[model samples]
Target: MSAAADFAQDRDTLHFRGDLSLARLGSLPDQLDRFDGRVSRVDLSAVSRIDTVGAWVVHRFAARHNAQVEGLDEDSQMLFDHVVGAEQPVAQAPARPNGLIRFVAEVGAAAVQAGRTMYGLLGFLGATTIAFLNVIRHPSRFRFNATVQRFEVVGVSALGIVGLMSFLIGMVIAQQGAVQLAQFGAEVFTINLVGRLTFREMGVLMTAIMIAGRSGSAFAAQLGTMKLTEEIDAMRTIGVSPVEALVLPRVLAAVLMMPLLAFYSCMIALIGGGVLVWLDQGIPPATYIQRIREVVPITDLYIPLIKAPVFGAIIAVAGCFQGMLVESDAEQVGNRTTAAVVQAIFMVIVIDAFFAVFFTWVGWV
Candidate 1:
C-alpha cells in the first residue's frame, strides 16, 4: 500500500494521497494535529479506496478542529457526502413578544372578538328559537331518532366527568369545613357547610363550567367543522332548516342534561364532604347528617338545581350559535370552540350571580 500526505501552507490546505482504510484511522488524527490548528481546509482528491471508517475519522477530525474538507475523488467523495449530509442544521423560528404590553394587546383583541361573537350568538339564538316555535306549531319537521341521539351525546356522555368533579368538590368543602370547625369544637358542622355549599353554589357552578368546557366546546367544534365542509349549506339546499336540524337538538339535549348533572354533582360533593369530615374531624355520619338537617334549607337546594338547567340552556344555545356563525376555515373552528367555552362559563357565572341576588331579595338565602 502507498500512503502520502502533503501540506500547502500558502493555501491553508492539507492534501491526503492514500488507500484509506480502518488501520489508517489512528494516524489520520495525528496528521491533522500536525497542522497545529493552522490549516483551514483539507483536499482529499488523491485519496483512493476510502472506507467508511476512514471517512468517519476524517469527518470527525475536521469537525472537532473546525476545519472544512473538500476535493475528494468519486469513491471517497461518496463516503464524505454521506457523512456531511447526515448532519442537519437546526432551524429556529423568530421569537414572539413576551412582556406585559403583548399580553394586554392579546387580551384586548380577544375581548373584542368575544364581544363580536356574543352578538352573532344572540342573533343565532333568536333565529333558532323562532324556528323551534314554528316547528312546535307544525310538529312534523322534528326527527325523533336524531333528537334522541343528540340527547344521549349531551347527557349520557357527560355524566362521569360531572359526577367525578362534583364528588371531589364535596370532599374539598367538607375538609375545609372540618378544619375550621375543629378549632372551635364544632366539627359536626361540616355536614351543614358541605350540603349548603354544594347545593347552593358548587353544584350548579361546577356542573355548568364542566359542561361549558367539555360539551359546549365539542358542540362548537363539531358544528364549525360541518360548516367549514359546507354540510350546513347542503342541508339548506335540501330544504331542511339548519336551525331545526342542528341548533334545536343540541339546545334541547343540554337543557335536559343540566338539571340531572347538577343534582348528581350536589349529591357527590355532599358525600365527598361527608367522607372528609368523618376521616379528619372524627364526626360520625349521624352527627354530620343531623347538622345538615338543621342548617340546609329546601330553598338552597332548589335554587342551584333550577340554575343548572338554565345554565345548560345558555351553554347549548351559545355553543350552537357560535358554531353556526363560524366563518372562514378550520382555524375559525378552533377559535369558536374556545369562545364557546369562555362564553358558556361567563354566562353561567353571571346567571348564578343574578340568581343569588334574586334569591336573597326574596328571602330564599
Candidate 2:
C-alpha cells in the first residue's frame, strides 16, 4: 500500500523506482505538470507491484506530456502498448463458435451474397435487353464491323478447340457403343447411337461448354479490365452507351457464331464417330450412313441447333455482367472471369434441361 516513488533525473531523462500505487494516481498529473513538456524520456524499470489504476496513471501521464516512456515491466509495457499503438486495439481471445453454428453462418452469408449477385445479373440483363431494343430501333448506330470482329474472336478462334473436343467425344461414344452393340449382334447400330447423340446433345453442349470457357472468360477479362481502368466510366461520360459500344457487339457475335459452331461440331463429331465405327465395328461407310439416316430424325438435329444460340446468349450476357461488376484490383479479374464461366455453364445446363423437357413433351426425345 506504500505510495512512495523514488525518482532520479538527468538533463532529459527521468528514472523511477519503488512501488507505484493507485493512491498516487492523483499526484501523477501534478508530477507531469512540473516537466513543462520538456522531459524527453522517463524510465520506469525499477517500479514494482503496479496495479491497473497505477498503469492508467502512468499511461495518462506519458500521453498528456507527450514524453517517451521506457523500461516498463511486461504488464505495464503491454498497457502502454495498448494505449499507444496506432494499429487496431488488441483483443482478448474470443470464444470459438460451435462448428455447426459457424457453418450455418457462413452458408447464410454466402446465400445473401449470391442473392445480391443474382439481382445484379437480372438488372444487367434488363439493361442489355433495352440496349438491344434500341439497337434494333436505330440500326444505323450499330457497329457491324465491331460485331463481326467480336464474332471472329468468339467463334472463329474457338473452332480448333471445339473441333478437337467434338472429335474426341465422337470417337469415345462410337467406341463405347460399338463394344456394347457387339454383344447384341448389332454393331451397325453404333452409327445411329453416335450420330443421334452427337447431333442432339453432344454438339450443342460441348460447343457451349467450350465457348463458356473461352469466349466467356475473354468477355469478362476484357470488360473487367475496362472497368478497372475506368474506361467504362469514360465511355459513359461521353454520349456513347457502354452497352451499345461494348456489350451489344459481343452478344451479337456470340449469338451469331454459336449455331454455326454447333453445326460444325456436329459434322466433325459425326465424321469422327463414323471413322471409329468404320475401323472398330467393321461397318462400311454406306451402311453406317444408312443406319444414321434411319435412326436420327430431322427434329433431333433441329433441337440442338436451336439451343445453341440461346446457350451462346446466356454465356455472353453472364460474362459481360460479371465483368461490369468487378470492383477489386486486377487479380479479381481472373476470379470474376472464372465465376462468369461457371455460371454460364450452369445456366446452359439449366436451359438444356428445359429444352429437354420441351422436346420430350413434343415427342422429340
Candidate 3:
C-alpha cells in the first residue's frame, strides 16, 4: 500500500496518521493549507511508517506553525532531526557594485593580458634571433629547401591577388584625387599623389595586410596542427630544434620576399594610376611618367622598402608565436590562427605609425 498522511486539525493542534512516506506527501500540502489560525503542535504517533519525505513534511509544518513535534520513534526522530537541520537558510549572494567599478576592473584585466602578450612576443623574438645566429654559424644546418618552398608559397602564389588589389586601389586613389584636385586646376598632381602614396605608404601597408591575413594565418594553422599532432615534440626528441627547422625557414622567406613583393605592389599601383589618368584626364603615359620623375623622388621608395622586412618579420613572428601558444585542442588551433592574423595586422600598423614619426623627425621622408 502507498504511504498516506491523514491530518485532523482541532483548533491549535493537528494530528498526523497513516503512512507518512513520499507516496503520500502529495496530499499533505493541500491538507496543511486548509488549516486556519495557528498550529501550536503536531502529533505524529499515528504515522505507521515514516521516511525522509515524511520527515521533511513534518519539519516544514513545524517551521510554519512554530509547532512542537512529538511521538516519533528512533528512526523517524533521526530523519526529522536531519531534515530540520538541512532546512537552514541559503546565504544571499553579494550585490554587485556600480558600472564604473566594473569598467575599471575589466580595464585592469585587459592591461594584464596585453602585458603577457607583449612579454611572450619578446621571448619569441629572442628565440628567433638566437636560431638565426646558429644557422649563420653553420650554414649547412639551415633548411634551404623549406625556405625556398615558403618563398614560393608566400611570394609567387600571392602575386595575382596582390596585383589585382594594388591595381584597384591605385585606380581608386587616382580617380578620387583627380576629381578633388580639378577644382584647384591641379589635376596633374594626381600623378604625384598616387606615386608618393603608393610607393611610400599604401603599397607596402596593403601588401603586409594581405600577407598577414593569408600567410600569417596559414602559419598559425600549420604550426598549431603540428603542435596538436605532437610533431614539434617529436622533432625535439630527435635532437632537431623546431625554431631552426620550422620557424627559421618561414621567417627567412618573409624577410627576403617582402621587399620584392612591396616593389611589385608599388609598380603595379603606379601603372594602374597611370592608366586611369590617361583615360580620365587625357594625360599621356609619357606626361604621367615625367610628372612622377619630377615630383616623386627615389627617397620615397626607400621608406616602404625599409619597412617591408620589419613588417614581414612581425607577421611571421606573430603567426609562429601564436601557433606555439596553441593548446592540445582543435578549437584552440582555429582561435590561435585568427589571433595570429589580427595581431600581425595590428603590429604592422603600429610599427608603421612609429616608423612614420621616427622618419619625420630624422628627415627620412
TM-score of each: 0.69, 0.78, 0.82
- Model 3 misses residue 102 by how many Å? 1.6
Model 1 agreement with the true structure over 1-365: per-residue lDDT tens digits: 55643334445676666756776555565665665655678777777667776677778767776778888766668778897777787999978777887999999998998788768877887987898898899889876777789778877888888878887888888777777888998876677778888888888898889889988998999899999999999999999998888888888888888888888888778778877877886778888778887899988878877897789889988888778767897889998899888888888899889998998899997
Q: How many residue pairs clash in all the candidates, one count each?
A: 1, 0, 0
> Which residue segments of model 1 deviate by more than 4 Å?
1-115
Using TM-score as the yardstick, the better of models 1 and 3 is: 3
- Model 3, 1-365: lDDT tens digits are 84467888778778888889888677787677666667898998888988888888788878788999998888888888888888878899989988999999999999999899999999999999999999999999999999999999899999999999999999999999999999999998899899999988999999999999999999999999999999999999999999999999999999889999999999999999999999999999999999999988878889888999999999999999999998768999999999999999999999999998988898866
| Residue range 204-289, candidate 2, lDDT tens digits | 99899999999999999999999999999998898899999999999989998999999999989988998887887677888878
Winner by lDDT between candidate 3 and candidate 1: 3
Number of the top lDDT candidate:
3
Candidate 1 TM-score, true structure as reference: 0.69
TM-score of 2: 0.78
The true-versus-predicted C-alpha distance at residue 156 of model 2, in Å, is 1.6
Alpha-carbon RMSD of each model = 8.7, 8.3, 5.6
Best by TM-score: 3
For candidate 2, give the lDDT of residue 167.
93
lDDT accuracy of residue 141 in candidate 1:
85
